[model samples]
Target chain A: MAPALFHLFALLTVASAVGVVATKNAVTAAMSFLLCLVGVAGLFVQLDAYLLAFLLLLVYAGAVVALFLFIIMLLDTQGQKNWGFKKFPIFVSLIALGLLLTGLGTFVTRGQLDAPNPNAAGGVGAALKPYAYQLFTTYLLPVQVMGFLLLIAMLGVIVLSKKIDGVEDVK
Target chain B: MIDFWSNLHPVVQGLIKGLAVIMVIFPLAGACSLAERKVSAWMQGRPGPNRAIVPWIAWIPFVGTFLQRLGVFHLMADGAKFLFKEEPVPGHVNKVYFALAPAIAMMPALTTITVVPFGAYFNAAGDAIPLVLANVDVGLLAVFAVSSLGVYSLILAGWASNSKYPFLGSVRASAQLISYELSMTLSVIPVFLWINAPGAPGTMSLAKVVEFQSLPGFWGGTWFVFLMPLSAFIFLVSLFAETNRQPFDMPESEADLVGGFHTEYGAFKWSLFFVAEYSHMLVGSGVFTLLFFGGWNPLPWISLADLVGWLHHATHAAWTIHPLFVGVLSLGIFLGKVLTLIFIFMWVRWTVPRFRYDQVMKLGWQKLLPLAIANLILYALAIAFIQKSAS
Candidate 1:
């Protein structure tokens, strides 16, 4: 049951991701991206990293895709639509596709997929607990440095976005 | 109940659990909105929502009853108002994408809570009851990946809306999330290293990490907060920006983006964005508790073994409440911690001023990234030194 489910999800994911890159309409492509994200989240679940799977769905699908939609909407590019690729681009796409297919075929034929090692100490949940422990103990300095870095970044963003002299407003 | 019975397949069960958590959290999110309003109101020295009372009930009730019922009904009324309001689809926008954007924004937020283990599991009649929806080993990674997708929703909404303000918001969001994502991931690497130091032999599981800290001495069995205060602080601040909370919420700053990425969104669709925001906050806080606060472990240093020993003596004969009950107790403790953290999020949101957009970006790139990398290096050296000294 698990293998079958995994296969189905992988097929859908890869296919949609391809569609995302291939589709001409930007809106259609964005929709394809959504499907691709969902498929990736499913794969995460299959890997037993439920937290990562959820994060994939929550952050990427939720915020990132929505951002894409907002940009597409704001652009209002329908009136200026350009449907077909130029001849040179088509040739390039075809060559790229061929290389990708060959690479995938080689990977499949090699049959070197290794099973998960159960004897490994941490397993899936291993990182979660110790991550907390080490953060406080061994890695304390870097952590403080990170806080400082964020503080600096925040100040930089503020300065950049501000209205400075001689800068023309885009709008 | 009957409908639930009919839909009892594993997938359905999973969906049901997901929905239940969403249902529980949704109202909580609504309450969060109210709390935001109230906190800001208090900060500014003004009354907030004292007059938004239950129609007939408030007139007939005493203080306690009226306040209790009003608190409960407040979210319902807010939801109903949103539902009944006219949903506007602005001109020149792609209708389908516009409609779908909100759902996209909300779905992942609701789903991310599944792997958050609020409690432990127990077996009854040989059937194990896992506290979480799914207890996978790579739970933390799953959380990280899912949260990362949230940025896309804002991107899509901005693009599909075909408006300038929304477009700018999306642009900012993309650059912001991507830039911060590196540091966010890097900041946590030290944690992973500590969990799986050399000779540990196996990956660090969440359960085992908690177990290791539950040793008997004063320093042996305590929360990691004391050991790595800096990491905890960094993680918390980054978490705020990662979730797009205030002081870090440049994407949706009303003064700047004019509603940010979802400026064109209205009615139920707009509400979905809020839903996603609150849900992300909830999940983020839950993970924060799990990672740094000793997850579900009460009294900081308390361990399951110690509890088991105490329970064995306390109940003596009629210890009928199975080990699962103990797990549930621990989970309850964990949930309490998460809620407290969430409250802190709300408190902070109302207290701080929003960061300027460029400031938000600069903080992520210039400061957090380098610092996170430095922390990772420092941790690596420390671990090496400790191993050598011990041997």
Candidate 2:
């Protein structure tokens, strides 16, 4: 029952993600994105990664979706302007789909779908413990770099959003 | 019997636990409301809610007195009032989302409690019984994740209302929550780092974390509060803003928002919003207790086992009891800490003044964020220095 339910949820989640990318209307796309996020969270729960599931829902669905909604509201774009697909978009999509399928086939053929090693020292919870260890120890440099990146992003956002004085640079 | 129950599917067990939490929280929320009123009344030198009686049961004499004494009547009366009250829908609102918002706000708060460790494990018919809904290893993160979802209720409620006040309130809430969430997450990372610091093969499970802190000796037994006081301070302050409590509750300021996000909602729907708020408060306080305070540690310096040992020695008998009894006692201790924290929340709520919207934003973004970052850096350096000295 759980496995069947999980499969159903995963299908819905993937479908909704595709819908989010394909949708023309920004608000609808945002809503679809939210559904995708929620579905993914459900998948996480099914995998017994309850913390990850909650984090997904909380961070992505809660804060990220809220941000998207705020941007949509602020922009207030209406009347559903027809954003026709670029020429060969279907061709590009098909290529991407083929690549995904090829990857999946390779993994299945390689027999990588076998049950996980039960004797592995850490279960799912233990698997995640290394994230913190890596963050502070081995990957401390990268962690600090990421912090710098976030700071830069923050500054860029403020500058872009703030009103400028009498200077409009034309292309 | 315990073994049979333990064999049930985890999801089913989770659902049962979730239902029990909801049942417990509803009355706790109501009691919180009553407590708030009584506390406020006393502070202002006035009587509060002493006259409201259970009309059906008040005439029964002895039974009525028992009902009144237990505050059972008040609970029923509150429920009745909510049921009978008019659910006013305003002219210019998205009715569906407006209606759904409160439930969205509440569901996550209620669900988050499922992972919270209430007690240590007990031997139940030769099986280990955990005194929590789900004994998932990532319990703390699960709690964090669910608590974070709580902002959506305010955001959706404000947007759905379609009124300028609610819209502003929601906007403020969204921005405030996002800003504070970063700091809150970052601050807690240090604690998680410390918990998993022994380079242990397993993750820092909540149960294990509690056990680690409950070690003998003064320094060993000291709560995270002593080692990481700044983190605890930042987390608590962020928690206040996260839950939209006083000083940070700019979203629901009566003077400005009229009624904030739930301006258009009434009766049961409005009650749901209140339920969500108080439930979040309860869960937030519980998290605070678990993370910073020694969870279920009777005294700051003493362990539960030590206390139980003392009890056994004092009685001068071979003490034997069901594991269920021990689990219940541990749960009681956890609850006692949570209640104390809740009292402090109410006390602070009444004592403090609400910050202006801009001030709230400034505090979160400019003040708390920097402070949290500094604390993290400081902790990292301190840990490094300590390791160096020890080595």
By DockQ, the best candidate is: 2
Give one digit per residue, the lDDT tens place, for model 2 in B1-391: 7797799997787777778878888789878877777777777788665656668778898877666655545666887899999889888887767887898888887888887777764463443345677777777777777777777788778888877888888888888888888888877767776765545555535666677567789876888988899999999998888888887887788888898877778899998889888888888888788788888778777877676667667876544334555567778898899888877887888898888888888888889999998999988888777766865
- lDDT score at residue A73, model 2, on the 0-100 scale: 60
lDDT, candidate 1, B1-391, per-residue tens? 8787776897777787777777788887777776766667777788655655666766665974657433556566778988999988989897877787788778768766766766764455532244777665666666776667677677778877878888787777777776776776776666666666555644434554565456678866767777666667778888888777888877787887799888998888888898788888888888777677877667766765566557768877444347656776777777788878877887788788888887887888788878888877897788778767877
Off by over 4 Å in 1: A2-11, A14-18, A37-87, A90-171, B1-9, B53-60, B63-70, B121-130, B304-321
lDDT of 2 by residue, A22-97 (tens): 8776756776788788888888778767656776876788788889888776666656577677769978989999
Residue-level lDDT for B2 in candidate 2: 78
Per-prediction DockQ comes to 0.31, 0.53
lDDT scores of the candidates, listed in order: 0.73, 0.78
Kindly report which residue stretches of model 2 are placed more than 4 angstroms away from their true locations once superposed: A18-28, A45-55, A78-81, A84-126, A132-151, A162-171, B1-11, B55-72, B121-130, B202-204, B317-322
Second chain alone, TM-score for each candidate:
0.88, 0.91
Give the lowest summed-lDDT range of ten residues in model 2 chain B. B121-130
